[model samples]
Each structure stands twice: as structure tokens, then as C-alpha cells.
Target: MPNSDNPSFQTEKASERLQRHADEISVRLTERGAVPNFPEPDDRTLRSFSLGEVAEILGVSGSYLRQLSIDGLGTTPETGTAGRRSYTLRQINELRAYLARTRRKEALKFCPRRREGEKLQIISVGGSASTTTSLYLAQGLALQGYRVLAIDLDPDGSLSKMFGYDYPGICFPDRYVSMYGALRYDDDRSSMSSVIRRTHFHGLDLVPGNCELEIFERESTKRFHSEDLRIADASIKMVSALKEVEANYDVVVIRCGGGIFLTAGAYGAATGVLRTVRPEWPEIMSMRISLSFLSHFVSLMEEAGMSVNHHFTKYLVTRHNPRDFSQQEAVAFLRKSLGHGLLTATVWESDAIRDAEVKKRSLYELVAGAVGRSAYEQAMETLNSTNAEVMDIIYEVWGRPPMYVMRASRIAGKASS
Candidate 1:
């Protein structure tokens, strides 16, 4: 049932096998009318047990190891001599530890529960111009049952737009989407719980945006009292507000206007967030564009001071065509070329997502009556579960999804392996 395309589905397939062990032997004997050849020995003299033996020691299975093998992790036939199946006790222990570590990550895919007096923190970042990859993760986490309040930090107001809130075309909604505005008029905000404006869905909520928000960037620049500017301090201020909100909600997803960095020329909000990041936290930047545009975008971002640090950066391919094998090939090529910054999910480009956004509805809300449900389901299959695989690793490192979501993008499939 696990496919390499779905990172979380990788292995952990044998969790059931470990439970079935005792009864399985009896069932096998009764069904086949023969005693099984399954190895049964304690730690001592259990030098060799085939793949099953290793699984027994690890309380896993050959299928599980086979998944790891597919990922090019842990012991393999090549790890032993003469291509004989082999697994060492030490390796088994190491693999178990690794699995445990990955499991912890999957657990945090949801929001952390709050204290009695805590207000839920809702942060969102996304835009209509340049899309960030974090939106996918945010949407996924929201689906996982987190109380998320997304802030539409983008001037185009796509995040608010996604919820069907019309962006005031004439005046910017500065007060509606800014930290200063929220604080000014947010009387009786009440445990920060009311901060979230619910969508058609149950767990997800948002504070809509208007075109007026464009002023903050300019206002922030002026307040800083500098010409050539950066938004690092503004970012810290926003984070502090989020920290207060966090007391109410478990997490916040912030949607930005364009790309990973806020804008070009001078001070950008993303620059501020990145400027304050600790070496420990990891952020996922999702880009929705042509593979042909990747290097160009990287170069442009670098010129704009948005260069990625390979150690903590990640690239996501969005609005892709799952049927377009070329896109998959392009991603692999980029990964090889970039060396360490490419990450992917099985989501395909579907018009339903766009249509749903246009209708101010979410996929879960519209999927039943929507057109792209099948493709969306396939896309869901592409991501791993919280219990196992690389998804867990990413969720653990990243903590929360990025703030924005891209709309009306097409997805292309990966080519043959």
C-alpha cells in the first residue's frame, strides 16, 4: 500500500505485522497444514534470521526494511557479503532509534493544546503574485485538526481572498491585517479565541485581508527612519504578537505577498523573519512556478538578497501537472543541481482547488461536490502519515506550515523512475 511517492507511507507497514506475529504462525500452520520456518530465538545465538529475523529483533518486518532500502537508508544486501540477507544487532538498534525519532515528528503535525488563559495564535502568509510552498503544509496541518488562524500578509490579499473575503480594491485593509491594527481595535479579544473567523470547515479559521494592507510596508519603512531598509524588526514585532496569540491557539500560519522574501528593492517581511531565525528552526519555502524558472528565480532572489542556505532551505514544486512527467524530471534535475534544497509532495495541479478558492470554499468543504476530488485524493496519497517516513522528519523540523497558499496552479507528475 505504501508508494515511494508518498514519503510517510514509506515502511511502518509492518506495525501490524509485529502484533500479528504470535497468531500468524498458528494461522499459517492451520491454513497450510505445516509447521512454519519462522526463526524463533532470543538475542544470544540469533546471529542470522533472514529479513524476518531482523524484523523480529526490531519488531518490524522485511517489508519495512524494504521500504528503507528503497529510500537508500540502513543495511542492505549490499551491506553484507555475497549478497546474502544480513542485519546486525547494532544496525537493528540504530534503525529502531531512527524510526522513533521520525515518529515524534509526525505527532506535532497538529497544534499544541493551550493553557486555560492562553489565546490561540493564528498567523498566515501567502500572496497572489508569488506563491510560497508553506501553504500546502498549512492546509495539510489544518486538515490534521489544528486550530489555525492564518493572516493574509500579502498585499494582493489572496489568503483572505481564498476565504471569499473581497479585497477592498480601492483602499488597503491595513488595520485588518496588521499587528498594530489588531492590537488597536482588538478589545475583549477574549483569550484570543475569537481571533479566528471560521471558514466552512471546523478547525480552520482566518482573519481576512484587504488591499489597504499595502500601506504597512511603506509605513514600516517610514517608521524605521531609514531609506534603504529591511523589515527584520517588524517581523520580530509580528512574532511577539503571535507569541501572545499562541497562548490561545496552538500555532499560526502567516501568508506572505510574494515568494519567500516579501518584496524587492528595500525592506521585505520575509527578510525580517529569516533574519531572526535560530539555527534550530527550519522553514519550508514552496514555490509555484515553471522548473525552467527555478534557476532564474534563485538568481533573482540572490540578487535581491534572498539566497538560500542549503543546510536549512527547501524548495517545493507547486501548480504542477501530475500527468506531465517532464515536471518530475525537472524537479529531480533541480535537486541534483542544487544539491540539498529540493523537497516534494505528490499534489497535482487541479482546477477544482482554484474553483473552490474562487467560491470561497475549502477542498474538504467543496471536494464532495467538486471536480478535482480524485486528483486531490491522489495528492493526499503522495504525502506521508504522521506515524512514519520523511513527512514526519519535515513536520518535526518545520513545526508549523508556512503562511500562504497558492491558488489555481497546475501540477505535473514525475516521470518514470
Candidate 2:
């Protein structure tokens, strides 16, 4: 037998120490009629902590807590107000574990706990180049504290580049790194997750698209003989790919590219389709044709009782000049023709937006004294307002009150400063 002070004796005494603790707990409870200091794993596991309480416990600032949520580290809080958001004891423990792992420089994983009725918005635009509009919308959504995944369905990869993934250059040699792999006829269904990439912005992820998708698009055309089946199949694959990671995002915005076939695919996958129409007659005429086509297809599908995901088509009046009578008239004409289908906010054409695009940066990132700073500031104001308005409309469509309006205001103030 080793001495009581020896390591071997201490190891043997550990169980005795626990037994003594239990005896003490019983003595204290009987004498004082109060609970002892023993750990209550059950109570701790069932406990819920408020956001502020969690922040206090963790010794972090409110802003830091918000960023943790933005970075997909914290659980989403109940809707109403940020102050009302609560974290479960389990979530708090998970966050602590995450912090410990981070301190050790280990790779971290984020798995979002999604609530019911969370929407998946797949945005599309009218005309030749809608990537810029899509990027701005995504930026706005992320700023509003929503997890956004922007999918660049275009072969040009313009949206990918806007988010800092260079065209053709960012493609990995070892794996099929784009949406191309997911759409292929192969049985590998997990390829969509591989295409998920984090962006420079918080709360935003990207599914990088490139010219490589053209090969898949062409192959799809050759394989599917019926136009309906072809469009249906493409939509199914695209939507399925999105659903693969649907739990991780609040919205999925697809900046579509390629020909009518690809456009049809987008239409099939959309929960909501945002179409931007310039204030011009020819473009307006083209939009009318597009609307008619969409309506006809939806009507046909409904009549057939086919199981399909129908989308609400919302029109945005872009490139407007309020002072220009022609542009104003175009907007008025659209409102009268489309009634409630048209978005209330109009996106003005500004050199500031163009300058930011030239620099490959977002309006929120443009600094003062940059070329067209005044114009950019004006554009930024309008963009913030439009983003909020559009968000309200979307939330209304999804049958929920807007959760991040206040957060959006905070983000706008931060960007302005």
C-alpha cells in the first residue's frame, strides 16, 4: 500500500472523495434544508439562456455575439427582437466547445438548426446581364443578418468573380468544383455540397458557377427529348441540389445564365423569381412576352394537376431616371399593367454603382474620396431603402413578419459610417 500523499494513493482516493462529497451533500441538505453545490446535469441540460445572458457568461460584447450568429456559429433566435433571442443550454455548450476548438486552431463546422416555414428564395432577372443585380440583392440580404447562398448558374461566372472567386482560375483540378457536377447524370448526389464555398461577406456563401456548366447544359439537351421533361428534369436537379444544403441557408439566390433552356430550369426551381425590367419599350415588350410565357406554363401545369413548385413573379423597375418623363412613364405603365405584381421600389441607374462594379467591390465597401463617392453615397442610400422594402415584401409573401428590419437599419448605419 502506498502512502496517502503518493499519486497511487490519490488515484485510489478519487472514488472516496466522490463518496465524501455525497455524504457532505446529504448532511448539508438535511441540516440546512437546501440543495448542495453538486452538479445538476439534468437541469443544466434543460436550461435556456437569453442572448445577453450568454454574452455575459461568455464575457463577449453584443456586437461579437451578433457576429458569431452572422458567421453561422450561434443558433438563430426567436423572431420579434434581437433582445428576445434565447440560447439553449445545449447550444451554449456547443458554442463553448466551438470557442475551445477555435483557440486550438482546429477546423470548425457549422450546422444550422432550421425552423419550420423558412423560405428559400431563388432569384432570377430579365435581359442579358442580371448578375450585378443578383449580387447586390445578396449583399443586402446578408447585411440584414440572414444566411444567404448566392448560386451563379451562369457559365460566365460573373457572380462568382464579384464575390472574389476569379473566373476559370478558382476551379480546382482535383474535384468537380462547380454546379456542373451536381447536374451530371452520375449517381453521386453529394457533389452539390462540394460546390458550397464561403465568401468574404459574413452570412453569405456561394455555389461558384463557371463556363464548365455549359458542357452539362449541352449534354442535358442531347439526353432529354421532350421539352417539358427536359425543363422539369433540370429544375428537379437544381432544386434538389439547393435542398441538399437548404437547412444551412435562409435564402438561395440564383443568378441565371445561358439560353432559354437554362432560364426554364431557373423558373422551375424558383420559389420566387425577381425580374428586372429596364424603363424602355422594347425591353418592356420583351418582359411582357416573358410574363405571358410564364403564366401560360403555370396555367397548363395547374390544369394538368401536375405536382410542381410554382413561384410568385415579382418585377423590379431598374435603370430608372425619375426626372426623365419616358422612364417615369415606363414605370407608371408597368404599375398599371402589373398592378400588385410590380415591386414598389425602383433601382436608379447611377455611375456610383458602375464605378463600384469596375472596382469589383460592393457599394457597402466603397470608401469616401473614391471616384464618384457622392454618387455612390446617393446610390447606397437608395439601395438600402430598396433592400428593406424588398425584404418586407418577401417576408410578407412567406407569411412571416420581417425579423431583421432593425438589424438592417444597424447595418445601413454601419455602412454609411
Candidate 3:
């Protein structure tokens, strides 16, 4: 009001202000020991699993695995002090392959990998705890012998950080390509395979996202305003990009963000959708809004002659406190409303999980006693239960028997005999 034309009265442009803030943050992070463009290939490593853990994961007896090691079959595990044995994830997978070949009748139970006729499973995970759910699901599947690819579609790169790839600190714009590179509308668009980065978890890979992914939203908005037919096509970008690398993976888990274009693309390409929710009123209401939006989106795709069908759409309850009466009632309400769509297992909110996250690691990456024994076991129990439920759904979709059910039946038969 004093002087409209004065340079001091002029406001800074939003883009410039944002750039300044980012630069300041970069300097602060650098000062705090975060190296810019840091190459951290060996920073995160998976811990070896003990013999009992390996046997449980393989659905076999510990003595059976011990005999195999004594007989020098498959990959020999590392023997520790007191003659205890531990197996690396790579070794576990080798054992899986060996068992699948030797035991033809239980081959699927041993390997559980996608075969010739089994279509690649593309799961789009979203809503509350989506990043954590995707991380655990991808790692859990890998531990169980499935080749998994996890794609981070969030511009914030939260899922990427969980995999030890902090794009903001480690990624070089000129050297690394993100998922946006593969989904861009321009001629410089690259293949999805080119952006795949291996994580420390065996048999699992990651396609990270960075700030550049935000550019896609702007570009898509412009195209939509121009009435571009390509923008309206649901099966254009993400579906085609994933098809390039479909043969290499047994399953692909995408961590969806809020961008409309990328979210729609994820929905269009998904074989299944996992919606995570907390046992709370606010989260339930938010999920309702999300479901409404999804319904409308599916209808629009159908009108456009694109069949938007998923093998399954399931809800997973996370961060649940069982002792809380209100949370219990919320879960009960969800179960009544969702019926079979809601998974049987709920992920309990645990201090152990929160502690691991603070250390920028997942529970699978930690040793048993790394975070108090009782807490770790409880956290793993819930996580494993939830993951196994999802795996049961996958098995059903592939027309295979549930591995747990089959194992239980085999145990009962052995007892009867």
C-alpha cells in the first residue's frame, strides 16, 4: 500500500521461494552428514535368518533342514558359535529351488513362483499405511521365494527410503532415472527396466520416484485441458510400461500417491488393489471418499470402453490397538460393512515397528533381539499373519491351494499315520 512499484514491496515468486527452501534444506542435510549424490550401494544389508526361522519360512522341520545341510544339499548355511546355523536370503531361495525340484508333489509349496500360465500379479496399494504395507508385502513375498518389484509412485519417495534409496540425498538428476522417466509423454521417455534398482532384500527390486515425478501431474493437466485423446486413454502409459518388464517379475507392488494421472494409471494396470486403513472414524470416512472416487473412476473407464476389472480388491486393517475398545468397535464395524473384502488379519500397532522405522529399517531387516524379543515377535506375528492372508488371496486367484492349509493337513495326516 505504501509503494506498489517498489522492488521491496514485490513478493517472491512461489517457484523461486520453493527452490530457495530446497537449497537451504540440502545445505542443512549436508551439514548433518547426509552426502549429496551419495552412492550407498552397501549401506543397507539384510540380516541372516536362524535355522528355526528358515525352517518356518520354508514350511519344513528344522531337523529336515539340518539333515540337508549335513548331507551337503542346496546352499550350505553359515554355522555360528554353539553349532547354530543361519541362512542368507539368497541361500534360502536356493533351498527353495532345490526342494521344488526334488519334491515334485509339493513343488508349488516349495517355490511359489509364477509359472508359465500364471499372469504377473500387479498390486496397487494405497490409503493409510500404504507405504509400510507395500514395503512389508514386497519383502515378505521375496522371503517366500517370489521375484518382486516395488514401484514408488509418490513424489515424496517415502517407499524408496524404506528400501534404502533416499532419492533426495542420493539421487543425481542426470545419472538416475525414476518411474516418471518411463511414464513421461515426451520422446525422452525411457523403459521401466532401465529404472529398476536392486535393493538389499534378495529377489526384490525397486523403481524409485523423485521430485521430477511431480512434473507429470503438470504435464497431464495441460494435456487434459487441451482435450488430448491420449490423456483420456486409461491403458496407455503405466500398463504399457509395466508390460515391458512383466516377464522378469512374479509380482509388482505399486505404492500409489495422490496424483490423479499416476493413480489412475496404477488403477488401470493393477491386477489387485490393497486399501490399507486404520481402525478409526476419520480414516474410515476418508476411505469412504476414496472408494467413491474409485467407483466413479471405474465407471468413466468403462464408458471409455476400457474394462477396469481387478482380480481382487481387499482392505487391510493396520495400526490397530486390540485392547482399545473404540478401535475394536471400529474394526468390528469395518468387518461387518466389508465382509470377505476385509482381510482376516490385522497389523497391530507396535513400538517395535515404530522403533525400526525410526532407524529407517523394516522389521525383516532386523535380527530377532535387535529390538527386544517380545516386541519383535509380536510385530512379526501380526505382519506375517497379514502378509500370509494376502498370499492366500494370490494363491486362490492362481487356482492353487493355500500353503498353510495344505501344510496343516499334511501334519494332521502324518499324526494320524
lDDT of each: 0.42, 0.66, 0.85
Give one digit per residue, the lDDT tens place, for model 2 in 174-219.
Answer: 2455687777766754467777877766677887777667767777
Per-model clash counts, in order, read 43, 0, 0
**Which digits, one per residue and each the tens of the lDDT, describe model 3 over residues 91-173?**
99999999999999989988998888999999999999999999999999999899999999888888988877776733344
Model 3 weakest lDDT span, ten residues long: 407-416
Give TM per candidate: 0.48, 0.66, 0.87
Which structure is stronger by lDDT: 1 or 3?
3
Supply the TM-score for candidate 3: 0.87
In candidate 3, position 300 carries an lDDT of 66
Best by TM-score: 3
Error of 1 at 191 (Å): 12
For model 1, how does the per-residue alpha-carbon lDDT over 190-277 read when each residue is reduced to its tens digit? 2223334555433456655454455555565565466543334444344445555564444455655542222321122122111111
Q: Any idea what lDDT model 3 has?
A: 0.85
